[model samples]
Target chain A: MAEEKIRVLIAKPGLDGHDRGAKVVARALRDAGMEVIYTGLRQTPEMIAEAALQEDVDVVGLSILSGAHMALLPKTVQLLREKGLDHVLVVAGGIIPDEDVPKLKEAGIAEVFGPGTSTQTIVEYIRNKVAEIRRSRKNA
Target chain B: MFDKEALEKIKERQEQWEETTLQQWLARLPERDELFRNLSDMPIARLYTPADIPDFDYLEELGFPGEYPFTRGIHATMYRGRLWTMRMFSGYGSAEETNERFKYLLKHGETGLSVAFDTPTLYGYDTDDPMAEGEFGKCGVAVSSLADMEILFDGIPLDKVTTSMTINAPAAILWAMYLVVAEKRGIPWTKIGGTIQNDILKEYIAQKEFVFPPKPSMRLIVDTFEFGAKYVPKWNTISISGYHIREAGATAVQELAFTLYDGFEYVKAGIERGLDVDEFAPRLSFFFNAHNDFFEEIAKFRAARRIWAREMRNRFGAKDPRSWWLRFHTQTAGCTLTAQQPENNIVRVAIQALAAVLGGTQSLHTNSMDEALALPSELAVRIALRTQQIIAHETGVVNTIDPLGGSYYVEYLTRKMEEAAYEYFRKIDAMGGMIAAIEKGFPQKEIADAAYRYQKEIDEKKRIIVGVNEYVSDEPITIPIHKIDPEGERRHRERLARVRRERDNERVRQCLERLRNAAQDERENLMPYILDCVRAYATLGEMMKVLREVFGEYREPIII
Candidate 1:
């Protein structure tokens, strides 16, 4: 069988118009051989989760710079779970405070990448996590 | 002058380090050689020494304050005469809400007013427009009509305080609304003073808030220049900006070069429109980002003034000294804020604001501490305004002019920046002009590459950002955050409905028809018709829709 491709949805949530970092990360993931869908700026959590469901991506990456991550991210995770998408890994990256990482992780976030985290690290993390999830499912 | 024994000791220590270095390991175990330097890599050695600026003629290069090639300072007394205008960029929710915020800012010792329009307003849409749904007052103030504009500036005298509006694409129409509001208050066109962020090239490069394509957008910008030069002589028609460029993750050098290139393109556009360089150039202003690199930011500003003066005089052939001067406003970088220990942002802003003052900025906007989280709360915004006040009042840095002028590092960086910027300018010239370069995706690629490389450096720990990768905290966000009004959109739409029902429909139709006619002809300026449309209370959406039909939308080319 051909190798299954990892699908990722990169989305910007909230009103922040700054997109340089988001665009760069989206391009990096694409270059790393993943199929990445970049939903442009000013997206709401409902719209993001809906798009992720439609795209049927293996991972959903949310980029929030407007400090609404706490308010927005949990709602997105809950929606994903309510829609029976809990298996899909949820990751985020932005100007997130280090203190908020544990809280986000507790809220069912798979990983939280802060600013200055390498694109390579993210790619590697996603690849490893996806493989581990698949391996566990096969054993089960 | 070192002693022989000390020199021998140093050499021995160096040899010991070299013996354990990676080169020694590489020789022992052969490996593929990697490229040492990248095209976008900023070199550490490009930094210092008198050798880089050996031909420095102090009087000519760093002339006295208010003289040609105004690198030292724009005015003779500078802050000694009057401190830089402390203008905080403030707006949010509907017009009435933003008007209250403006009044609050002014009451809190803010010297000037700076308006931030909502996304729909920036894109020229009425609150009732379908495309403007869910986006009326989300980002900034929603000004959909002359009624909204009047409400935004309610109780504030136009002739008293100079306002700077951060709106592009629909800049001409929004500006027309401002003029109409001023006229209603018995203020003459000549008596009004303010600046419009009318730079379109940077819109394509960074902000991505553009409406029309480059050609039609350039036409509208030139129209503002012509109108302002003839009518509002004190008004700065365009604030050639680099703030958005830096915010888009460009390096200091790229920000300086790309911004000036955009400025040159605008000057070319004005001259092509038959306006004299001296006539409209004096009214031209600049806006820049004060990033974390303190010395580099200061050097960039100095080099900008010198380069603009030289190019305006030697290239554009302007005889008036005012045409050569590059007066500018500075805003601390929003990208530098951290959501981790949000309070740490206060210190960062203070340092950046000090750099801007040292760089001789004419006006300043200090970013609030809570910006990385949301739009600044009233308390946070007040603190930001106070940061500037403390700098101007407490810090003696403003006591003298160009305090850091003779520093060896600053002088070297200034000259190096000028040389590097001119090289980029020459390349852009080769690519035709700013518009051609943008269409070809040259500047966009360069900025993207620079952004990626900088991110790499930060990841590799070559660059250290406090409260982020290093010195991290485990505390929760204890600060209060600003919340957007849930009723903002509903309220805005109701106001729009009332205006639509009450305004003279026939006059609106006639005014829009005149604007449509004026837009079709290159010979007629659109400002007069825009003012007429504003007087009729025609919505921003209606006027922009007409222009949108004539000048299609601009789609950015993806070239990463």
Candidate 2:
């Protein structure tokens, strides 16, 4: 049987036109032997979640630069839950303040990568998370 | 005098670590090649020296400020005579909402106004248009007609303050709308001062916000130059921009080289249109990105001025000194801001803004701290503006012109940057200029390759991003984020509907028909006809649709 490649969707939510980080992350993920899909700038949360569901990726990374995280992040998490995509790991990045990480975690975000975070750390985190999911599913 | 023994001791220690010379090392590592790195990579050498720029000529390469080959600055006083304009780029929701923001920015010590239009408005769409669904007032303010334009400006006097509009593709139509509004306010076109980011080359290169293909876009730009020279004498017809290019992941050198290449292309286009080079050249301005590398960013700006001056005077045969001067506006790199440590963005923006000031920007926009989170809250914007203010007043660097000009490091880097830029220009020329290169996927590929290399280095731990790799942060975020009103879109659509129901439909139809006719006719200037449509209260979508039918939409040739 052919090895099933890990697929990831990197998306930018809302009016934020800042996508350098997202593009870099996408490129890094692709290089790390994962199949990456990048949703270009100015995507809505609805659009992002829908893309995640349609693409059926192992991981979904939401890059938010417009500071609408509190309002937008909850909507995406809720959408994912409603879509029965709780198994798909959700990670948020961009200029998120230190104090909001707990709030985001509470909202079901798996991890938060701030500025200066290395691409390797993110890739490794996804790899570990995906393996954990696989182990849990096999036991079930 | 006694350092010889110390140097010998240091050399012995260095030899212990690595005994081979550079040449021997290169021989062993034949795969290692040095020249130009691809677009996305963090530059291999963070700091350059005299060895990097050996053939530096002060008189020929970097002449004094306000002189020929103006590498140091455009003006003698630069910021001393007048500090760079603190222009806040503001817009959101409807015309009325943006108008309020404009006034608020001006009241809060903003020197100039830079308008940001909603995607629909940018693409010349009316809020009520079906294609404009869900994007009416999310990104920027929507201005569909002269009525909207008038409401957008309201009590603001166009004659007194300069306004820069970040719009392209449908720039002529939007400019026409501004002119009609100015005319209504009894302000002659000559009295209005501002810049139009009418750079379509960059649209093809990085932004991907283009409407027409290259040839027609160039024609439209030339038409604006001709029209602006005749009427809006104080206005800058085109802002050759590298801000978008940098934001799209280009290095400082690529941003400098590509932006200047675009500017040169526009000049060439203008000459072909039979306009005297000096007549329109003085009005041409630039916009750049102030990224993380402080000294490198400064060197890029200095190199840009020198290269522009030499090319305009020597290559283009322009006689006017004003034509040689390269004035620019800068915005701190929004890409550099981190969402994890949102408060850190304030420090980052401060450093970037200072780099811009030292580099001699005519205008500047400091990104708000909460930018990476959402549209900047009012409080966040105020802090961003204050960043510029503190630099202007508290920082004494502005007291001296080009304070870092003669520094060994700055001078060397400036030359290196200029040389690297020329090398890129030569390559682009070989590929048949920017248009031909772009078509062949040259620039796109170059950028992508560089981006890939940079990412690889970060992954391998060759590059150390301060907060990212080495320093671990387990802390959560606590910054306040700005929230967009959910009702904003509904309110905008209702207002657009009301305007359509109330406006003179017949007049709108006639004006739009004229615009369409003008667009179809190659010889006719589209400005006057567009002005008429604006005066008729024709929605942006209506006018754009007509032109879109005439010009057809441009589809980018994806390279990567």
Question: Model 1 residue B398 lDDT?
Answer: 89
Q: After TM-score superposition, what is the CA distance of residue B436 in candidate 1 from its true location, in Å? A: 1.1
* lDDT of candidate 1 over B152-176, digit per residue (tens): 8999989989999999999998999
| Clashes found in each candidate (C-alpha, N, C closer than 3 A) | 3, 28
lDDT of 2 by residue, A55-113 (tens): 99889899875455776777788898889998989999976766678999999998999
User: What are the DockQ scores of the candidates, in order?
Assistant: 0.23, 0.22
Which residue runs of candidate 1 sit more than 4 Å off their true CA positions? A1-3, A11-17, A31-33, A37-57, A60-121, A132-140, B1-41, B45-52
| Residue B494 in model 2: lDDT | 76
Best by lDDT: 1
lDDT by residue (tens digit), candidate 2, B199-225 = 999988887667788988898899999
